[model samples]
Target: MAAAASLSVMVLLCLAAVASAQLSATFYSRSCPRALATIKSAVTAAVAQEPRMGASLLRLHFHDCFVQASPVPSLSSLILSSPT
Candidate 1:
């Protein structure tokens, strides 16, 4: 199970790198002007409250992507939904 999860993460990371390469620097500027700043502030506050929260959040994201068996999940959906 651990190895499978790790492989999933590796595959996703590689796909993300390739997909990100096609995105423009200002891709979200017109669609969501404050998106980056909002994300940065939220992450900064979470990490400041608990340094380990950063890694925990990342692990949760990966788990959401690969561990869920029903109702296919996507990173954007996970980000928009309640963390609990």
Candidate 2:
């Protein structure tokens, strides 16, 4: 049982490494050319409007990433429900 568990863990770790290797920092650069600049500008404007909003945005982002099962839907809900 112990050996089986160890092998399972090793397999999971190797799979995780392989999955992460496929990710790239510039993955969206070509598909969405201005995505980063757009995000930066929006964030800058939002923070400029109210400095505390930066913290709130970060917290929402964290929740979206870690707490939500589906990030896209959670993020969409957040955006739609947010006060404009």
Candidate 3:
């Protein structure tokens, strides 16, 4: 009985992993840490180039991260709208 239970659990886990493997086009960052730093620094330096663009990108990333981390759509949207 225990062996069957474990096997069923393992099968479910494998299926879950397989189901989640698909990713959206935008999430492909070859170097995530470097990309994050680049985006942050670009915004920080945007006091000169495109002021609003930097801020907008930062907000978009923050929101993107939140949704990816937490799939509860309504909660993510509400938090995204709230003041940063």
Q: Any residue pairs clashing in model 2, and if so which?
A: none
Model 2 C-alpha lDDT per residue in residues 6-27, reported as the tens digit of each score: 5655676676668655688899
Task: List the lowest-lDDT window of 10 residues for candidate 1.
Answer: 75-84
Best by lDDT: 1
Which is the leading candidate under TM-score? 2
User: What does candidate 1's lDDT look like per residue over 1-84, in tens digits?
Assistant: 556555665676687678655668899999999999999999999999999999998988888766775454565554455333
- Rank by lDDT, highest first: 1, 2, 3
Off by over 4 Å in 1: 1-26, 69-84
Query: Can you list the residue pairs that collide in candidate 3?
Result: none
Candidates in descending TM-score order: 2, 1, 3
User: What TM value does model 2 have?
Assistant: 0.54
Across 1-84, the per-residue lDDT of candidate 3 in tens digits comes to: 556555655676676668766665556366463776786776678756866876677677898776567643343444455545
Q: Candidate 3: what lDDT? A: 0.63
| TM-score (all chains, Cα) for each model | 0.47, 0.54, 0.28
**Candidate 3 ranges beyond 4 A from true positions:** 1-41, 69-84
